[model samples]
Target: MTRPIIGRVAPEQWRSTGATAPGQRTVGEPGTARIAVDLLGGDHAPAVVVDGALRAVQDDPSLHLILVGPAEATDAVFAALEPAQRHRITVVLGDSAVRAVAEGRADAVVSAGDTAVTVVSATRALGCWPGVRRPPLAAVLPTATGHLVLLDVGSTVDPDAETLAVHARLGAAYATAVHDVPEPRVGLLTIGTEPGKGDRLRRAMPRRLAGLPRYIGLVEGHDVVLGEAADVVVTDGFTGNVLLKALEASYSRLGGPESTRAAVLLGVKGVVVVCHGAATGADLAGGIAFAADLHRRAAIAAIVTSLSDNPVLTYNEVSHD
Candidate 1:
């Protein structure tokens, strides 16, 4: 199938009806959040996606949804809701979810569809922050102490040291802004804590990350669950994705702290949440809820503010091996 053309709406026109200006922090009615969901996303689309959308509205009275997909699929959601609840939903027949956000029809987007598609669409529609060549997907994982942010989970699989360094800065800002960590300790994930332990990419990261205020050297895989070494763990997308899925599966069978089965895309101008393609109704609902929470809290704006306050070193500025 051909990729959908996104970003038809110009950036200046984003949220024409909202009180806030484009690219500014979005402030909506207290507790009110409008999230656009991609109904055709996920392996078991429309069906599970419809179920998730219903669950989300039922759970949050102040939450609004913009369902993007075929009429038949969205009809399922409408059928499942009461007349009074139906007003909370807005239907967009066959449009990309990201487009709804860019067009100012939705506050955020949730998709269990193709990761690459969602990332590309969001980057085009919302644009990226300054110096972010490739955006990273940041996932919050529950740890023994509390929770730590794990980033680059399937965004740039073959990232360079420079990309990883950028993600480290992004993760630090996310932990500070969203998790409320006063001073986030950033760590590079590698095979061992010893110097020069990991692959070529890992070995090259310390030099790139040296300027970061809270760089904590290398961390082992176990450090992810322990949460002792750092508040934010940075890795290339390939390793982060594999580690995240493995831990999710382990937690599922062995019973561990319940972590959201969703990841938020960082470095973009808008709030976008992504779930696994095989996500269930409950997972999709969680993703939708997660997106809503981010919108209500003005997370993107806060993170951007944090980054602006403490500027991250750009990849071009640092010397390469």
Candidate 2:
């Protein structure tokens, strides 16, 4: 089905309307964040999503939701909210929550859907930043000292050196923009801290990361957990995803600081947060809050500006042996 073209609205021209026209952009009052929630995106759809949406709206007074899913599911959300609170929600009557952002109906999107689908939809609808072939999902994990940014957490599984290089820059920029880290340290995750310890991809990374400032060389798995070595850890999506899940499980069983179950899809034009398929209502709510925070901070735009301002971060394709 061909979707209608939606005209983009300038930030200054944004206004709130009770009902949105096709392709007509709507914005809430100042300081209001409109987040599009995917009601059917998780393993436990509507039920958990409804709970999460209600929780988010109740907690954040400035939040407005554009619920996207089946009528019955979205209706569940509306039914749960109070008569006055119901005014904060707008229904999309479709599955793609990312589409709401692309159409300027929402400031950000939160989906627990398939990672591949979210990545593809975001790339197609919102578009990718320059030099980004495959956008990487960057998750922030609580480290011993503070939080660290981990990238390619299930976005690009079989990435080349150039892809990881792009992710490294993205992760660094994300750390600085979101975490307020100064000259964030970027590290390549591998089996050992030694230079020649990892596989072909790890071995090829040093050359690719030549000009990245504050890159402190190869970091081991412990470095990711300890947070002593680097502020941003870069790796292939497969490895990063597995590591994040393992850590989450460990934190659940043993007593430790919890890792974030949701990740922000970087290198894309808009703020899109992805939660795990089996995410709980609390997790989904956290993801929605994360999206709202990023949107409010203008984090994506700041990251893009940081990248554009830094001459060293420009991606250059190099032949890998």
* lDDT for residue 278 in candidate 1, whole number 0-100: 93
Best-matching candidate per TM-score: 2
lDDT at position 59, candidate 2: 89
Per-residue lDDT for 1-321 in model 2, tens only? 122123332222212232453566676457788898887889998788877877888889899887777655544554565656566666446758898889888899999989899999999999987678899999999888988998889999999988898899889888877888757899999998776889999999998787787889899899988999999999999999999998888878988896657999998889999999998998998999999999999998888767766666643321122
Candidate with top lDDT is 1
For model 1, the run of ten residues with the poorest summed lDDT: 9-18
Kindly list the per-residue Cα lDDT of model 1 for residues 192-278, writing each as its tens digit. Answer: 888879999999899988888889999989999999999999999999999999999998989998999999999888999999999
Each model's lDDT comes to 0.82, 0.81
User: Which residue pairs show collisions in model 2?
Assistant: none
The TM-score that candidate 1 achieves is 0.87
